[model samples]
Target: MSASTSAPANSAPVAHNALPPPSTSSAARSSRIAPHSHIKGLGLSPEGFANLDTAGFIGQNNAREACGVVVDLVKSRKFSGRALLLAGAPGTGKTALALAISHELGAKVPFCPMVGSEVYSTEVKKTEVLAEVFRRAIGLRIKETKEVYEGEVTELTPSESENPLSGYGKTVSHVIVGLKTVKGTKQLRLDPSIYEAILKEKIVVGDVIYVEANTGAVKRVGRSDAYASSYDLESETYVPLPKGDVHKRKELVQDVTLGDLDAANARPQGGQDIMSVMGSLVKSGRTEVTDKLRREVNKVVKSYVDQGVAEVVPGVVFIDEVHMLDIECFTYLNALLESPMAPTVIFATNRGNALVRGTTDVISPHGIPVDLLDRCLIVKTDSYTREQVSKVVQLRANVEGLKFGDGVLDKLAGEGEKSSLRYALQLLTPASILASLAGRTQIDIDDISEMNELFLDAKTSASMISESGAAFGS
Candidate 1:
């Protein structure tokens, strides 16, 4: 038996276009770059107090000021031989200070960061690793002005003829390319190889491009902005037209590392053919750079610097957990610091008095030798106060797209004071999840209490384990 229910006779149907269409907008992205991604600068004001924006720093005023002084010294080219050492307890903002310094130094300056444990390698020697890092921290900015043709490509045509070697095929003899600039226009008859390069670059009419005067190299900048407005939506990159004549002199700038130069010189090309490329792909390992070759490269770099064709840029090398390096590496660093080409070095450690890694009878400050320590300007980061910890918790919550209810941040800071700052920071995500599960946008004290019941801090866990020695089947 089937029974059917009748629909309501007075119900009105909604029209397909009853409401205005939803507005189109770019999606707002939540930035979860890192725990400390919100840090933009040193957060220091002109009088050296905290700035109004805070700049991601809540405390550590002394350390930030010291780093500001270091930045000034670095910019003036007066910082050499002596390295900056940041010594503090774990969870203090040591690495954050280094990052702030790099940001202040400008984007063009190279900043090489590494961990001391990364120096250990089965296939590479330790000294070679150190030397490689030293070379990588140096940069060369080469600037040259050359005559070239650059503009939007108004027309592109290739003239082909019958191949002499193969009658069934045709080869491009020469390409007729027309370029239009703001000031003028020019027509060029380029070689067939340049045409091939143009094809390889996916260049076509309405794209802005440039050709090298001497090398005849074709480089496509982007699609001209004049053609960009024709499409309601596009995926191609667009650039404004150049502001000069089609045939004119242009300045070209290239920034490269000394390590890059060393690698280029270390590996000699097999050939330009496909077989040579396949052979290269089949045999792959780390390239070995020699001392003699490095010296030659340095001489060439010096010559270029003297000829006003290039300038040497002193960069920064930050080694975190630097106490992991042993006596030999420290000795090498002492000599390396005296070199004329050494980069600015910054060493960070969370250790106090400890045994040096490679030594049996030696125990020194921060696990470093006295001589090396003497060559360092030590900056110490202090532990955060309760207020600072609360501020830091708020900053972190903002970074992770979480909100706090009344008294939640203060409760978290108190927990941090009792246990540790890191442990307190670790609870924010889980607390946020608990809040989400409760169908609330703001994390409350009850969520924090639930997290505390689920997860124990290090001290609490250690105490519990000691109280029940045999429970773990030890």
Candidate 2:
């Protein structure tokens, strides 16, 4: 050891193994915690959302404008909370607009995407699913800093041995890494793979390293103190420091999901620490949560926020194909939309005047009930115009890394106007293949026309099979 090496003055090991003092009274030991969180600063700001533009939501101006209004209302918390319905024909950008709105609002609030049909899980009640969705949207992100041991690698040794867990002739190698620090010295037993990582980073005997507290990710931070004189600390000057002070503090941020909170609150007194690990295993909407439990969770959240250990972030619960929900789910939505605790619900559907599922009643516009529809800020997505369709095709082509000629775009736009935008986009791949087969990389009008006929033939065949109710060959 170097003559300058010594323990830090404040490096006395904390009494982490000590037992806690017992409570003297039953009242003191009561597990009940007082409600603390007053929900504030959760409201939206127009200035915070000023940069959010709907330019990415191409082809549907009405839908985009409607979403913009919803965004404004949701951000401002103006209307005491309401559902927004995006009603349109299939492939009319209803889902896109919903996603865009969520993305815009998500910058400040939590934006969680869920499907309507996900509530049908037989493992848990549908109401629980809805409750979890709402809870997840208003969860928190907690960050804590803790001091950790860190040092430069002084010596490394790799040794291989037969794997004890394996019956077969399998082998495993371990690397013993010796580190020198200002605080002291530590030797860590690590896998040989990690030793290779150290070597790959050119980390030799005198390179400083740190281990992340939460993730345990090891990284080379800087060169060692042994070469302090070789390089300048700052402004071409070498400043040497005493050895026993080389340590690092790791900041660990944990985004506590609703599931984690549930697990935490579910534990009995003195078992809260175990819940931290169990929280990651708990899936949202897996079990029914009672109103009492919800209240408890809210209290816990408030307490965490109040103590400055965590901050609550509002989230978006976007349920696409919302018309798939049964009447019972709709009933739940009716009550949820009126509640202040509810997250911003974005529902999108393609149904127009369909029978409400699990009921004899037929509904207008969508399968949704009238009361729920009234609560929703309804937005209708119209079929795309030819110009908009062209732009979308170009955008899609660029996204998919496809090359297309001007004539091809014009042809696709014309076809989209005659049929639907989805059908036009579907034809691009087949047309591209045809173009490639014809010794050309760029999709042209001829390729599109050929693919169009093929699409028509496939559609006709599908209709025939549906009508005949027989196998395709038969």
Candidate 3:
């Protein structure tokens, strides 16, 4: 051994091997969350409209551009009267386009999504259900400047006292919380109510929290960044040390959907007891909110908007399979779109000239009334090309953490071209299962072929059903 750089005479050989490393195997990290869970944004540049494969989206630049325009209109408050219609074939990413718009707008903007048949609830009037969704799509951003004790928690000691009402357990009289900011640290003798809030929030010594002085509300910001590099176990969201004094006036922006206000006012909770909560839950079983109560809530919301206490943020209401909404609901929707408190609406459908639901004689384009269609800016999403389908399949494989054997992806893409993109993507998981059963880690062409034979695509299934004489149309 070398003289100066030799190992210590008393050093144990396996001292560095104290703990095992984190697992990074495919089985450990694999997830089949959703087809579009990887979709984050519209996959476009912030300034120029650059068509690039980003945010798990492959193509459809035109639809994305139109959605971007709608997003712009939503932000500028000019998308009230008009609506955006996503007209496309199935699996062409219409819903994904709408979702991308909401993502582009940010999390504060409320985006209410519903199927057309959801309005056909037995308990509520169709118009009432539609009105509730419209209200939910609109957000009220309330800004409040309140005195809050905000800092990284250095110490959390709950002082306990004997309970006078119950002999079973002691009650927390007050909580001694030592809060530290960059400026200075302060100890707070908070109320017992605030201690309950702290327990509810799961606040620990390393967590950053803020206690509202007036309402006695406690909010956990996140864990302090000082302990971020300490260990790796459960996921940790580390935040920087709070700025300014431990006790300061912080301006908090609270976002609430209009439906939330209506519900709160309609069935106001009297107390925090189990009986009261149960009563509220039971009363909430009635789906419909009365029109008179909604009007009163609207008046209060308008006053709040007028007084500058809260600003109205109109968001998107995406109705998928909009053709299922009947003529009456469509009429109500037309009136709702023109209302002063209306939010931007986006419709999605795949129909061409077809019978409008609830109409025996009248045939409208896309199964929607001509009047509503005229008010919409139709953005068409094209079917995926063979190359695009291949790319999408590859993307899905990567997302699902599956290894593709030689020529497997090309074979799948060929199948996609023959049948449909949706059909091709559906075989991926089954093929992986087959490969696993055959003692192979990667899915080969044989696995793909076996899956193709076992499962029928939509087209093949339809053909079989037609042959069975089940009254299916050609």
Candidate 3 lDDT over 1-474, as tens digits, reads 111122245643221113333565845755457867778888777763736778778889888877887787777887778889999999999998888888888877888999999998778888988999999998999888899999999999999999999988998889899999999999999898888888888899989999898998899989999988857665878999999999899999888988998878777658989998888677747556787998898898888888888998887799999999999998888999998988879999999999988889989999999998988999999988889999999998888888998998999999898898999999988777655544457887877776766789888898898888765543
State which candidate, 2 or 3, has the greater TM-score: 3
lDDT of each: 0.86, 0.68, 0.84
Ordered by lDDT, highest first, the candidates read 1, 3, 2
User: After aligning candidate 3 to the native by TM-score, how far in Å is the CA of 205 from where it should be?
Assistant: 6.1
Candidate 2 per-residue lDDT, tens place, 13-47, comes to 22212333455685554332211111112122343
Per-candidate TM vs. native? Answer: 0.88, 0.63, 0.81
Model 3 scores a TM of 0.81
Model 3, stretches more than 4 Å misplaced? 1-30, 45-52, 152-178, 187-208, 220-231, 234-241, 268-284, 465-474
Across residues 1-474, which tens digit of lDDT does each residue of candidate 1 receive?
Answer: 000011134533322223422445666444455866887889887765556448888888888889988888888888888899999988898888888888888788788889998888887777788889989989999999988899999889999999999969899999999999888889999999999999999999999999998999888899998877777667899999988899889989999999989989998688899999988887757766899999999999999999999998888889999999989898998988998989889999999999999999999999999999999999999998888888888888887778988989999999988888999999998777665544466787877887888899999999998879877676
Clashes of each: 0, 7, 0
lDDT of 2 at 359: 83
